[model samples]
Target: MWVCLVVSVALIVARLALRKVRGQKITHGDYWCLCAAVSIVGRLLANHFLLIYGSTRILSAERRIELLKPGFEVQASEIITGSKLVLATRSLLICVLWSLKMAVLDLLARLIMKMPYERKLLYVFWTALFLTYLASIIPVFVGCHPFKKNWQIHPYPGDCVIGNVWLFTYEVSNILTDILLMAVPFSLILSVRIPGMQRLRLLFLFSIGIFLIAVSIMRIVQGHNSRVQSAHTLWASLEILFAVIVAVTPTLYALVRNRHENTTYDKSHLSMGATARTHPGSLAEGDRYAARVWTELNDSASRTDTTSIEGILVERRYETSDVKL
Candidate 1:
């Protein structure tokens, strides 16, 4: 998770630099990616605290007794029990997920053909994401009588929502959002005619949504059956990492493109190879050669500012009108 977060930040910075050098304005997607990065860092902070003071740790007898007291006066600041730890984790994870979602959605809005009818539908989809964010978060606070009661070391079950109900709602909605974000864009991708390889790349990028769903499903399975706190924490962190990865992946491919573009050796050899492979019955090689050259040419074609940032890897306008949507 930490590695993914670091890579995400690095890519965002590099992408922004690329945009600046090209004299393009920073975009909504970029802003959302920045927000996503911040939320991811926030999630990491929550994860660190979970490892140190969350349910996974062994508590002292004295500490346990102190926490269990009726008049102990526990507040949100304290993290003595499992409830507080889980609450904080849930809250932060939801924020991270939604920030990434908005980033991705904004980027897609630019890429997907912008017909008024389609735009209305897209707006509706964006609203759904926002509502999903609310559904995942609002309950974390209000599930208990007093919001602080959620994290308090109550003697027994206080006036809180049933655990089963909370879990089912949160998990189902989360899973639903995960599925929708990935599945809805299929038609849009198919709408724009592109080359086989680029189409494949887009499909692969969209497939990250499937991975997100898989992780979410795994989390549900692990959460339902596992009794170990450590294992639970690990699963939770893994999900967050996957979310960050999906969010950052769109802009990331450009880095690979940039490396090939910047390498004098590769460019020189590519030209030499292109000339050598220009024989009859070498149509396949010609296409491959053309693809590489097109990638380079395409990179130079984008006159607008489109920094690589956004979730679902669905940001950056056309990734130079060819490497992206």
Candidate 2:
């Protein structure tokens, strides 16, 4: 328990520190991944605590078996009990929050494509993510139940209530939401004025997000039974991690490109635009433009008057045109 806890904490801390060093803002997908990582840690702690303190507390092996009477079925070790159901419920709420975050992100992306108001679109995405976070509490309470011994172990009594509803909703909503998220970003990417081949290449690169959709599909398929005990947190974690990578990779890739361009321009006599010449077999004029703009953008970044910090100017633009073809 200690080892897992320590490792999870270290991973989380490292993730945060890296983002901080890179000046990375939390996107909607990043928001959910952070939440999932925190929740997994919390769930692990709670489960270990329950194991230490609950029905099996300090009991000898002989005594443990003696406690299990005939007709009172003892489920498989991994099956969801009331406590695990509660954890599953919390996880579901996080999933819903992810869905809502994506919804707003898609809306904002649509707005950016049509209206070209990047700042306002970003603000809308921020507001939506915040509001979606608040709404997560609904599923938390609705799906989770407190730990109570002998609460619903017997199948005939049908004591289960809270978890089933959440499981169903979570699975269904996630499927739809994952597909939506995978699709929406493409709309923005494809609409970029870059040449078709370059646009296609970028589109293909971004399409890597669909792999997350595959993860979602697997999670949903496996989640149908509503037996929280059987639920696989490791598989769940994979989905969360991949989805986070989806959101984070683009930003990181853009930053790296910009940095590289800036470095090249600092050493060369050619203008930033000259760096945009295309390589063979690669599709998309946007790629070339992006290549150029990134160089110019980096050059602009290099020209910042670091000594006169008081009057420094920062020109940070997210417009598609700035992506250059």
Candidate 3:
């Protein structure tokens, strides 16, 4: 989870920096922001998993009794509550939040870059997928008892008996979602009418998603093992760490690439502080607002033609999200 925390911080800093440069305010499109916040939550969940596991590892019956004393109850209850929160968070983020963000990213690409795809189709598909997964969690929610069991004794009840079936569904769906999301961006980017060599180069770079594929696989293995070991166990902790890193790395790369090139607001093709006049007959207000925001946000994004560096000569069309000044 420490890895997640570190990467989460980096994603936030980078996202904030890029937003500042573009002069764009936060919108739902800023999925990395959500990722960062969710990651911290994931860490909290992971930490609780560790606490419960440690509590279980005490060899002596007397020590176990001592650990469960009234004074320690408060802390133990907190740990159990944290674990439940983690499970809930993991489910919501994996099934709903992250999926929505992916769809939004696709929608943004289509809006900003004229990416061609049935946007409605993609959105509907993802929305359905998310809702189905969320629906599956109802069983777990219904199973949670307020004060029936003695998983741990804090003033409040613990979530020890709640089976991890919900967690398992979340993990499996998350792995699938990661692959689909990673693959979809590449598809959208590659479908653009760019030169073959240029397209190949872009795909090669974006194959970085393959790295995330590896992370997802590892997460599935670790998370599945973690369910039996209490929410605060070590194996579970590793799963959280893996998730944080996976979520943060892409954002970090985008941020680092932006910074290394010293792309500032003024140097971009679209001038900073320029507003796109609202076209009465154009797309919805949300689209127009997003466009205006993006243009302002990327004001300092590297406008330099990267063909020279990538060793591919190609024509470029620089369309940006139009941001109102």
Q: How many clashing residue pairs, candidate 2?
A: 15
lDDT of 1 by residue, 1-325 (tens): 4665566566666666765665456667668777766766776676666665544123334565666566644422345554566676677767767777776675455444322244666877778887877787778777777565554543443435223345555667777877767764565555443456666766787678777778777777766634355666566566666766666576555444444323432332344332333333223432332211111212322212232211111111122223211
Could you give the C-alpha RMSD of every candidate to the true structure, in order shown?
10.5, 10.3, 9.4
Candidate 1 residues lying further than 4 Å off, grouped into runs, are 4-8, 11-14, 55-85, 158-167, 225-227, 254-325
**TM-score (C-alpha, index-matched) for candidate 2:** 0.52
Q: Rank the candidates by TM-score, best first.
A: 1, 3, 2
For all predicted structures, in order, the TM-scores are 0.66, 0.52, 0.55
Show model 3 residue runs off by greater than 4 Å: 24-27, 31-35, 38-117, 132-140, 143-163, 189-197, 225-325
- Which number leads on lDDT? 1
Candidate 2 wrong stretches, greater than 4 Å: 1-36, 47-85, 92-140, 143-150, 154-162, 195-197, 226-231, 260-325
lDDT for position 222 in model 2: 74
**Model 2 per-residue lDDT tens digits across residues 1-325:** 3444345445444545554565655444345445645665665655454443332222335544544556435432322253444454355446533643453363335224323344555675566455544454455454424433323332321333334454445545555555555554566555434446555555665676677667767766776543443244444555545554554455444454443422343333232242333333323545323221121112232333222111111222233554422
Q: lDDT of each model, Cα atoms only?
A: 0.55, 0.44, 0.44
Worst 10 residues of 2 by lDDT: 308-317
What global local distance difference test value does model 3 have?
0.44
Instruction: Give the Å error, residue 251, model 1.
Output: 2.9
